[model samples]
Target: MTAVRFKPTLLAALMAASLFQSAWAVEPFVLKDIRVEGLQRADAGTVFASLPFRVGDTYTDDKGSAGLRALFATGLFKDVRIQVDGNVVVVVVEERPVISRVEFVGTKEFDKDVLVKALKDIGIGEGQPFDRALADRAEQELKRQYLTRSLYGVEVITTITPTERNRVNVTFTVTEGEVTKIKSIRITGNQAFSESTLISQMDLTKGGWLTWYTKSDQYARAKLNADLETIKAYYLNRGYLEFKIESAQVVISPDKQDISIAISVSEGPRYVVTGVRLEGEYLGKEEEFRKLVTIEPGEAYRADAVAATTKAFTDRFAAFGYAFARVDFRPELDRAKGQAVAVLVAQPQRRVYVRRVNVAGNSRTRDEVIRREFRQFEAAWYDGQKIKLSRDRVDRLGYFKAVDIETVEVPGTADQVDLTITVEEKPTGNLMLGAGFSSAEKFTLTASVKQDNVFGTGNYLGIDLNTSKYNRTIVVSTVDPYFTDDGVSRSYDLYYRTSRPLNTQGGDYKIVTPGGAVRFGVPFTEFDTVFFGAGVEQTSIKGDTGLPVSYRLYRDTFGETSLSVPLTVGWSRDARDSLIAPTRGRYQRLNLELGVAGDTRYLRGDYQFQQFIPLSNRFTLGLNTEVGYGKGLSGKPYPVFKNFYGGGLGTVRGFEQNSLGPLDIEGSYVGGNRRVNVNAELYVPFPGAGNDRTLRLFGYMDAGNVWGEKDSMSFSDVRASVGVGISWVSPVGPLKLSYGKPFRYQDQDKIQRLQFQIGTAF
Candidate 1:
C-alpha cells in the first residue's frame, strides 16, 4: 500500500498550492485506473464520488487538488491526499473516528436519558462522529438546562475517552449547585400602592411556607416577565393610564445562593373616564353597540373594561359573518385635569366561511366523537360565539387533555378560513381499586373497570364490584352518548346488591336486591338535559337473625320477596366553566322516583343546587344545598331500603358516614324519609402556587339533617360543622381532604373529624 506523493503544479482556488508535497511537481495526465486507500468505515465509492476527474478522463493538477478539497469538505475524513502514478490516480483518506457511547455523571436533577437526548440534539451523541466544538457546545447546553431550575453555580465538564474500533465515548460530569432564592424585591416610583401590595400581585415570592412544593422562589426569565405584565395590568386597572415599567434588574449574590430584583416604574396621574364614544361603522347597530359598552362616565379609566368592550364589539361583528372584524380603541387624556375619553374604532372586514375543519392529535379517538360536539359546522359562516361554544363542549367531554382551535387563512382565497382543532387525547380507561373503613361497614373494598371512551366510539362501559361487612354489590353498566345521533344518550344498568343495617342488638340480617334499569337522556338545549328511566327490582329478606322492625313488618305484610317497578324522571343543567375546578357558575339537578306498580308503592324526589362565585383572582365561594322527600303512595308504606342516609362526605363533613336520621327500635341507624344537606365553602389559592386552580385550600361550613316520616322538619335540629380542606385535580381523580370540627353533637352522635375521598369538593 506504499504510494508516492506528488506536489501539485496547479491548485484550485482558495486551496493551498503546497497541499501535496513531493520532491518534484507532477504534471496532469489521462487516468487509466483509480485507487483509494486508508478507508476504515467509509466505502471506496464515497472517495470516488468526491473526485472531480474520473478515470479515463483527462486529469489535471487543479482537479486533483479540487478532489482532495471536496473529500475534506465531506467531513468524513481528517486528512486527504492525492498521489499520481504513471497512468493511474491514487487517493488516500484518514476517516474521522466515530462516537461509540454517551454517558452522564452526577446529574441528580435530570434523568440520564434526558441528558443523552439533549446531547443528541446538539450533534453530540452515541454513534456520531466526535467533534470537539460540538462537545463544548453540549457542555454549555447542559449548563443552560441546570440554570432553568435556579442552579446558578452549576458546572459541567466533558471528558472524551478513546475506545476500540476507532471510536470515542463522551461523558458529561455535572456539579449542580444549591438553588438560588429571590432574597428581596424593590420597587421605585410607586405612590398609589404600597410595595407589599404590588409584590403580592406577583407569582414570584421571596419565600413561603410551601416553597418546596410550590417552587415559587426559583428564578426564570419568562416567569419574571409575566410578573411584570401583572404589575402593569394592576396599575392600568387602577386608572394609571400612563403607567410604564422603566427597567428591571436582577442581581445574584456572590455565593450564588440568593438573588435580588429591582424594578423602576412611572405611575403617572390617575385619569377619570369622561365618556366612551363609538367612532367607526357599527353596521347600523349603533344602539346595540352602545348598550355593550361597560365604561362608566365618572369611573376610573380601566384597561380591562376597554379590552372587554373591544372584544365584545368584535364578537358582535363575527356573529354577523364578519370573522375578520377589527376593533381597537385609544384614550385621549387631559393630563392636567386627569380626564380621559375612550374612542373606539371598529371595521367589519370581508365576510368569510370556514373552508374545512381539521382534527389532529386524536390518535385513540374517532373523528365523529369530536365533530358531534361542534356547534360550528364546516362551510358555515365563521361564528365566533359558536366556535367558542364548540371548543368548550369538546373540552367538557373529558376525553382530551387539551382541546385547541385556531383559524388559519386559506392561501389564494379572498374570504375563506380553515379551522384546525388540535387535541391531546388522555387515557379514559381505568381499573380502579378502593378501600374504606367505617364503624357500621367495618371494612369495604371497591373495584371497578370503566372506560369512558370505549374503542374510540365515545361510549361508556363499566363493571363494578364491592365487598363490605354490611353491603356488597356487583354491577355492570354502559352508555351510548350518541345512540340516536340527535344528541340523545341511552344507558343500561344491571346490579345485585346485598344490604344489612349494622347494629350490636340485632343479628346479621340481610336483604338482597337484584335490579336492572334503562335510561334515556334527551338534550333539551345546549346546557340542559332531561332524563327518563324505568327499572324492575326484586327484594328478598334473607336473614331472620335480627332484622329491623320496619323491614320485618314490611316483609311480613308484602311476603318474603317483593317485586317493584319504579319510574324515574330527572333534569340537569350545568353552566360551570369547568367540572373539575369551577371558578364561577351554577349547577342544578332534580330527580323524582315513583313506584307505580308491584308490592311496594312510594314516591321520592330530590333537588340539588350549587353555585360558585369568584370573589377575586385568588378566592372563590361555593354554595350547595340539597333537599329530599319520600312518602307512601296507593295506601302502601314506603320501602325501608329506599330511605335516605345523611352525615357523610357528601352531606355533613364532621359526622360519620350514614350516621344521621332516626334510629330503628333496635338502636341501629336507620335512614329517614326526608334528607337535607347544605354546604358553603371558600376556596383560596395555595400559597406560592402561581395561579394554579387545580390545587387549592378551602374553608367550609356544613349544616343539614334528616327526619323520619313522623318527625317534623326543623332548622333547630340541623347539625353544623366548620372545617378546612385541600382539593386537587390529581392524575387518578379529583381528591379532597378535610378536617372538620362539629359545633353541635348528641350523646349517640358519631363524629369523624378527618375525611378523604375522590370527586368534587362537595
Candidate 2:
C-alpha cells in the first residue's frame, strides 16, 4: 500500500476531526447496554463501578465522549476505545501497570520507610499504577529533603523493574554526596564586641569534637535567623537600639563538610530616653497610675522597662472595669541626635460588666473543677485582682496545657463583656510502670501509680514500688490539696517502706520505717508561702551483725515509736513559662524543719536557687544550687533519718548512690551530716525538628560534696561530673537519658552512669 503524505498541521487537524466524527457516530448505539473488556487485574464490575453514569441512562454523542475521557483520566488505563455494534456500546481499555513493591538503594541520609511515606505524600507508590509524572515528583521531594540539610550535590535516580501479574517493582537509587558543616563564623564591623564573643552568642556551632552527634555544625537557614536575633539582642541590651544585621553569606568548602559564615553588621549610635509623655484619657486618675510606671526619663532606653510600663497601664485600666483597654507606645525618633521620645497612648473603653464566664477546651477535667477556681462571677463588675487569681488558680491545677482568659464584647451593649476562659487539658494521671538495665543497677523494674486529682476531687494518691538489690522501696501516700477553700493547701501522707543498699558491707543493712505527716501551706503574699507540718515515725534497724556499735546504740535509743512534731515553713516564687527548658526566670525555695516534740530532736534547713538565663533566643543556661544543714538539738543525738545523703545521678553521677554520706559503724558510708550541690545545664533544641519543644539536647556540669559539718568541708572530698544528655517529650511521656564521666574523684575508677526519672513539672 502506498502511504499518503500531507502537511503536519493538516494531518493533526484531520486526526482530531476524525476523532470527533467517530464520537458522533457512536451516538445511536449509546442508547443500548454497555459492555466492558480487559479484566486481567480489575474486574469488569470494577471498571463499570467507576463510571459516573449508569447503564440504560441517556447517552448522547457528548455522553459517550465524556465516558471515555473519564476512564482514561483515572490513570488506571493505558488505552480506551468505544465502538458501536448495532444498538450496543462496546468499551475496551488496557489497564496500566500496577506497583507491586518499593525499594531503595544507596541512601543513608533517609530511611526506606521515610522515603516511602514521602513518596506517598506526593501522590505516588504502592497499588496505584505508575506514571512518569508521579515518578518525577517523588524524585524532587527526595532531593528537597537532602538539600535542606546542605546536601547541594545530591542526585536521585528511579528504576522501574517489571514483575509478574502486570506489576512493577520501583527502586530509588540516591547519591547523597556530602554533608556540609560550619568551619568558622566571622563577624565584621563589630567594634564594640570581639568576633568570638558575638559568635558564641549564636546557637549554631562550628565543627568541633561534639559535631558528629550534635550536627550543630550543619548549615541551616534557621540557624542564620537565630544568629541574627542573637546579634540584635546583644546590641540592644547594650543600648544599641538601632543596630541591624546587614547581610550574611554561607560558603561551602571543597569537601562539602566544611562551611564558612560571614556576617555584616551595622551598629548605629546608642540612644537614651529623653522624655516620656502620656497622651490619652486619664479618667481623673493619671497621677495615681503614672507613679506605677517604673521607667525613668533619664535612664537608658530599655525594652523591658517599656513593656513593664505598658503592662502597668493596661492593668490599671482593667482594675477600673475597663476590660477592653489598650495601651501602646509610639516612639518618636530623632536620628540626627540619636535620641527618642516615647508617647504612651492609653484608651480605656466603657466599663463592662461580665455577663457570663464560660470555660472551654477542658476535655478531661470537669467544668466544675475549673469553675471552683474562678474568683470572678457572672453579671458583676470586672476585678483585675480576681481575674488574675483565677488564672493563677487554673495554672496551679497542673492539669492544663494552657489557660487563657478572653473578654468578648456584647454586640449591642457597649458596657457589657462576656469572659471566655479557655483551658487546654494535659495528662493528669502520673502512674508509670517502667523497667530498665544498667551496668550499676543491673536489671531493675519500677512501678508507680499516682493521681494528682483523685476521682474528680482535688485529692492526691500514690503508691511506689521498686525491686532491685541496689534500690528497693515500697510506699503509699495520700493528700488533699484543698482541705479548705480559704487558699490554704493542706496535705497528708502515710508511708511504710523498707530499703537495703546493694553496696553495703559484708551484708546489707535494712531499715523498716512507718510514718505519717500533715502539712498546711499558708500564703503570706502572692509570691511567698509558709508551710507548717507535724509527723510521727517509727524506724527499726535489722542485720545488726554488720552494724557498728555506734549504729546499734543509736537504733536502741530511737526504737519502736518516735513521737515528733515537726514545724515547717517554706516560701517559693515562680516566674517562668515552663518548669522544664525555661529560657528566663528565677526560682527560690527555702525550707526549715524543727523536731521540737519527738523522741529525737533536731533542726534542719535547706535553701535552693534556680535561675534560667537566656543567652539568646536559641540558647538557655540553667543554673541550680542547693545548700542544706542539720544539727542535734537539746543535747540529743542527731536523727539518722533526718541526715543528708549525696551521690547518685540526682546528685553526683560519677559516685555511688548515698556513697558520699558518713561512714557507719560497720565501716560503710551511711549518710552525710551536711550537703551542698550545684549543677549547670545548657539546653538547645534537637536538630531537624525546627523549634519543636518536644525534644532537646543538653550539656551539664555538676559539682557537690557531703561532709560531717561545715568545718569538715574540703575541696579534696568534693565530687564533680560532666555529662551530655538528651530529653524528649514522647507520646508515652517525657524521657531523659544521660552519659556522664567523673572529673574530680577520690580514687581512680571507671565512669558510673545512671538514669533517673524527672516527671513533668508545672
Candidate 3:
C-alpha cells in the first residue's frame, strides 16, 4: 500500500511546473492511449472531460501542466501526476474523500436542519469534497451565528471521522452558554439634552422584564449602529445641525454573562433656517416645487423637514416619467449667527417607461388578485406616487405578511425599466375556539372559522358560534369584493340568536330572533363606501317565568311572535394609517334602518365618529363619539327588541353589562331608545417594550347614557368614568383589560369596575 501527500500550495506548484517547462527543452510526442487510475467514487470520464489532451494528440510540457491545473481546479482530487511509458500516457490521481453524512450534537440554539443549511450554503455538506479549509469556514460561520444571538461564550468543535470506501462523516458539536445581556448603557457628552432624555431615544436598553421578547438587551452590532443613527436623527431634528457620535465602545465581563455599552456624542450649536431656495430644473413648475419645501424661514433647522422636501421633489419628477431624477439639499451654515440657508437642487434625467410588470412569491393568492391592486401599468410612463399607492393598497388587503416593489433597468434600453412586485403570503384562513370567564356572562364558549381568501379567489367566508349564559348566537356569512368588477362588494349573512337575563340562575325567560340579510357596497370614492341592505327578521318570546315586566307586556301586546322587513342604508369613510394600531386617522359611520311593513314598524339610526392624533412616535390620542336614536312609525310603539343597551366593554367600562337606562317593574334593565357615548384615550407603549406597538397602555375617560322612550337624552344624566387599560395584539387575537372607577354613581346602579375582553380592540 502507498500513501499520497497533496501539497497545500497547488497553485504555487503549478507555477513552478510552468517555470520548468520554460527552462528545460522537452520533446513532444503523440499519445497512443490514455488511462486514469486511483478513482474510487469519481469516474474516469470525469477526468477525461477535464483533460487538455486526448489520444493521438501531441503531448508536451505545456499540455501536461494545463491538464494538471484543470484536474486540480475541479476540487475532486488531492494529487495528480502524468507519466509516459513508451508513448502511452498514464494519469494517476488521488481523489478527495466524499462526505457521507453530517450530524450535530448538543445543538439547542438552532435546529439540526438549520445548521445543515448553514453548512450547505458554504459548500460543506454531504456528498461534497472534504477539506480542512471548508471545515474551518463552516466552523467560523457557526460561531458567527451564535454571536448574533448574544451567545458570547458559545464554542463549536468539528470532528471528521473517516468511513469506508474513501468517505468521511462530519459532526459539529456546539456548547451554547448563557446569553450575555447589556447590564448598562451610558451616554456621555450630551450637553444640550438630559442623559435620560437622550437614552430614551435609543433602542438598546438594560435587561428588564420585556427584554426576553424585545431582545433590546442583547448586544448586536447592527442594532448598535441603528441606535446610533436614531440618536443622531433625534439631535438633528431638534436643531442640532452639527451633532456627531464621537465613539462607541462595548465591554464584556470576565464571565461573559454581562456586557456594558458606552457612547460619546458632541452637540454643536443650534441653527435656525434663514431661507429655502429652489434651484435647477423644475419642469416649468417652479411654484409647485416651491410649495413642496417643508423647511420654513425663521424656524428650527430640521433634518427631517429637509429630507421630506428632497423626497417630495424627487417624487414630483418621477411623476413626470423622470425616474432617474436626483434631488440634493445644500445647506449654508453661519455658525456665528446660528442660522442656515438650504438650497434645493434638482436634476431630471431621461424619461423612462415601464417595460413590464412581474409578480412573485404568491403561492396561495391568484396573480389576478394582486395584479388588480396595481395602479402602475406596463408600457406606460413611470409614476412614483402611483407605484407607492399600489404597494399600500396591496398591503392593506392583509392577505400578505410583506409586500415589496423593486425597479430594475431593462438591458439594452436606456429609457425602459421593469417593475417587480414581491409578496409574502400569510395564512388567510383561521379556526378559533375561545373560552372566557366574566361576571355577566359567567362561563362562555365561542368558536369561529373564517377564510378571507377562499380558494385564492379574493372571497371571504366565515362561521361563528357563541354559547354564553346571557346570549347564544350562530351566524354564517360570505363576501365577494369584486361582485361588479368596479370595486363593488356583496355580502350575505344568516344569524340566529337567543338572549336571557344575565343574573338569572336558569333560562326561564328568553327572546329568540332569527334573521338573514343581503348587502351591497358601492364605492363612490377611494376611502368612502355606501351600503344598502334588506333583511327579514322573526322574534318570539318563550317561558314567561321570571320575565321582566317590560318583556311580558311586549309579548302580550305583540302576540308572542312578530315579523319585520327592515331596509338598511349605511355609509363609512376610513383614512387610518394602520388598521390594527392607528396613530393618525379619522373614521366616520352613519347607519339608518326602517321597518316598512311588518308586525312592528320602527325607524332607527346611528352615527359614530373617531379621530386619532399622534403625539409622538410612541404615543397617540384618540377621541370617539357615538349617537343613536329610534322611534316607531305608522302609529305603533317602538319594538322592545330593538332597544339600545349601554355599559360593558364597548361602552362605559365602570358600569355592569346592559345595566344602564330604564328599569322594568322587577328592577331589571329594559335598555332604551336613545343612546349617546363619548370616549377619550391616550395610548402609550407598554413599559420596557420600547417602541413596540403590539402591546400598549392607555388612559381613558368615558361618558355615556341611555334614555327610555319617554325620557329625553341629556348630557347632565350621562355617567362618567376614568380608567387605565392594557391592549395587547397577541398572535391569537387582540385582548383588552381595564380597571375603572365610576366618578358618578348611585347606590341603585350596578358596578363592574374590572373588565376584560379577548378578540377585540379598545
Candidate number of the best TM-score: 3
> Across residues 17-42, which tens digit of lDDT does each residue of candidate 3 receive?
66647664358988899988888889
Candidate lDDT scores, in order, read 0.86, 0.75, 0.88
Clash total of candidate 2: 1
195-271 in candidate 1: lDDT tens per residue?
98898888888877777777888888889999999999999998999999999999999999999999999999999
Candidate 2 Cα errors over 4 Å, as ranges: 1-58, 61-101, 110-117, 125-130, 162-168, 189-194, 253-255, 280-296, 299-329, 346-472, 477-510, 516-536, 545-550, 554-584, 588-640, 643-762
TM for candidate 3 is: 0.91
Error of 3 at 244 (Å): 1.2
**Whole-model alpha-carbon lDDT for candidate 3:** 0.88
- TM-scores for all candidates: the values are 0.89, 0.68, 0.91
lDDT of 1 at 79: 67
Estimate, for each residue in 1-762, the C-alpha lDDT of model 2 and write its tens digit: 999886433443345435856655654433557788775787777667666556667656666666665666566776676666676667777777898887888988777888888888877779988776678888899888887787867888999999888888989889888787777889999888898888767767777665665566788888789779867887876667778899998887766667898999998887777898888997999898789777677766777788889988888888889877898888877888878787898899778788999988976677877888888999899877689989998888888788999988889877888889998877778978877554445666778999887776767788887766545677777776667776677877777767654335556567666777888887777667678888776766777656644456777887634556677777778887677657889988888988888677888999989999888666788888989999888999777656677776667766666677556555666565589999988988666433445577888898997776434777777789998888776554566677778888865332467554443321
Q: Spell out the clash pairs found in candidate 3.
A: none
Residue 392 of model 3: what lDDT?
A: 86
- Superior candidate under lDDT, 1 versus 2: 1
Model 1, total clashes: 0
Q: Which candidate model has the greater TM-score, 1 or 2? A: 1
